[model samples]
Target: MRLQTAVLLALTLLVGAGVADRALAWPPDLMPADALPLKVALRAEAPAPKAKVSPVTGPAAACCAVLELRQYTLKPGQRDALIDLFDRYFRTGQEAAGLRVVGQFRDLDDPDRFVWLRGFPDMSARATGLAAFYGGPVWQAYREAANATMLDSDNVLLLRPAIAGSGFADVTPVPPPVMPSPAPLPPAPLPPGAPPAGHGMLVATLYYPFPAHDAAAAQDLADAFARDGAPVLVAAGGPVLAAFVTNPEPNNFPRLPVREGEAVFITFQAFADAAAYDRYRAHVGTPWWRGHVLKGAPEVRRLAPTSGSRWQGPF
Candidate 1:
């Protein structure tokens, strides 16, 4: 399929028909000003055109571009100010540059952090649009006004679509149907707060290096996470999430906008409910978590939102 056709199809499936055309402003009121900025671009080339696959299989070619910005810590009561800044600067700027503002989120567990994802057509357009916007008088004025309160610099990441049905389209191209699996009976509801069955949790430990860790140390950390059954998790906004770590790469997508020596680590886990999360937290205390995963790591941050909506980057 041609790139344009695939994009149209994916947009139809992801965003409702006509929704993408709707003129929406950047930085909806909910976002914060200090939010890091990400610039994502999708490849203009189409993946091999194949018969529509299962909805669960997701889209074939990448559809939207995603950019993310991160704010490490906010002032005592600057949430509203930050939100206003995001609206005035980042959101408005992106929209003016002709991009689609997809979603924005604040970490439920960490109010100090924020994330936003926006979409674009392709790489060349993205580059041209960004250069024009950043170099324009409007962005310059906004930048000056935003300078004083900016918590950290922004990081940009370019992304292509991964999962099927991940786009904002309405009429998705259905994939070839497969034999349905035998439906299994639902499990009995557990009493009050019992942990859900078959659910497991993996905590991501991000390592940011001060003076860039030696390749050996980096590999060791990666190997450790792999051995512990938690390989480095890569998601759309994976880079921003890694910002809480040390030694962030420029191209790391969805990363927080943090500086060196301010390195941080984020530990993540999955659980059925609060009880399960508590159990795991208790079982993995400072010593265990530190010694096992965070050994040699400087700063550590942990968050687990009850709902996926809380932390708005890549899943």
Candidate 2:
């Protein structure tokens, strides 16, 4: 299908499923003197189209223009508070300023961890948008509330989509929060076809010990998984989202910490639940993984989205 048609279909599904509603702006009164103008900075392209077949079954394509895999280590018992603040105050100003708030979630393995994703049309846009959001009014009003919930906000990886049709489908903007609430509620369940919670999406990051400085070598690795390895996992009943390869460009902003050194590749997939994950695990021992996807023994981690996560639509 055409990219535009696919995106429209994705948006319709999200809205019908009630995932399109949520807060998107920060308080408007607090714009900073030097902040980049929100309107100019937010010139983003339409989200990339979803693939007709599994990305793993084809060649690697650039997913989103630029993707950031971010993880925040919050204070103990503060994950919910942090997510509440984010849901209420972060999305609006951030997206308005230029960033695409892809999704937010609680780390299933780490109670104090909050993980989320956002995208940009390119690196230059990322730098501009982040600057505006940090320097803008919404953050000014709620910075303290937001900061109080986190102990660390430095775990981040800059990536590009690894396969054809690997990026997220276009989504409707999240509605602005209607009013401040005494407590933030968990984000609604994902729409039909999304991986279920107990056995929901398994977002895995594969950290390779060697530098993937060679473009050909990197493509080879990513393609191996996309074209060969991904099909094996799907046959086992796991639905794959997109896989990504780290972008080697130096961090444009010296401020935020993204892991440097070592090559990394990430995969997003989902199963029915824990039992389903186990079933996939049983298949992992097969030759394909040992000889291809995991042949190098990359560091792999699996994560599930927390209750307050807001990812609605075509994955």
Candidate 3:
């Protein structure tokens, strides 16, 4: 089904918004002399009991699952073995199990880490399919063979589709848009005898549910970091890029919408490089994040760019 239709159905199934006078009002152009009499007659009619909708009772329209796999350092010439095994086993197994792989990326900084997303019909189907896939013979053999090359820590996230569309589809391949080579940025004067490190860039994004009451509080945290902490690093001759919060919108997976309990607010920050990102995280994000943002919010997810990844605009 199309995303808009699914959203409409989901909203109808859930608690509906109260009817307003504006909605009931006939358009001036469409109204006739008899409209006033009809309105009066409708007002005289008795009200009916509203249908009760249980908040937690209904099935989600769709679900998205993220699986993160970390591999151990490969032996000499074992890289090809691991790749071929993943191609021949994991990909085929997941397809057979009825889960659609949406996105896949290999970490540029850490070659061992692999991240992928999958979509399911709903929560129940996701749970059933995942259990059956893991328990099946194909999965067992694949796991046993890859055990030595796999990292101990793996992460999985089972998320309900917030709006009405499926997650990224594996079948319809999309190539990333090529970024133009950087135009020569204007040079800034540096302190005498300072050595130059090439320009680096980092981007961070934060998402929050809509109608957030604590937007001011979050903005304050961002302001403090930029004014107080960033200046110190910049004075030490570090290059800083722009930082700002983005407005929330529908997720890349059309099924997830702003109306759902998903994030309503989004904050994005861009820095020069990994060193700057690390410094900001340590000096700014870690200390302030927990008390100001994390504590105030229910959930947050973070990601970094790598090979085979696509940007899903803020949601």
TM-score of each: 0.39, 0.66, 0.36
- Give the runs in model 2 whose Cα sits over 4 Å from its true position: 1-63, 173-199, 209-217, 283-287, 292-301, 306-308, 312-315
lDDT by residue (tens digit), candidate 1, 88-181: 3455455556654443434445665544444555555555555655655555655644444546446332333322223332112322222122
**lDDT (0 to 1) per candidate:** 0.35, 0.57, 0.36
Count of backbone collisions within predicted model 3: 15
Candidate 1 accuracy as TM-score: 0.39
Ranking by lDDT: 2, 3, 1
Which candidate wins on TM-score? 2
The C-alpha RMSD of each candidate to the native structure, in angstroms, is 18.5, 13.6, 19.0
Please rank every candidate by TM-score, starting with the best: 2, 1, 3
Estimate the lDDT of model 2: 0.57
Regions of model 1 farther than 4 Å from truth: 1-69, 87-89, 95-130, 136-141, 151-205, 208-212, 231-315
Residue range with the least summed lDDT across 10 consecutive positions in model 3: 13-22
Per lDDT, the best of the predicted structures is 2
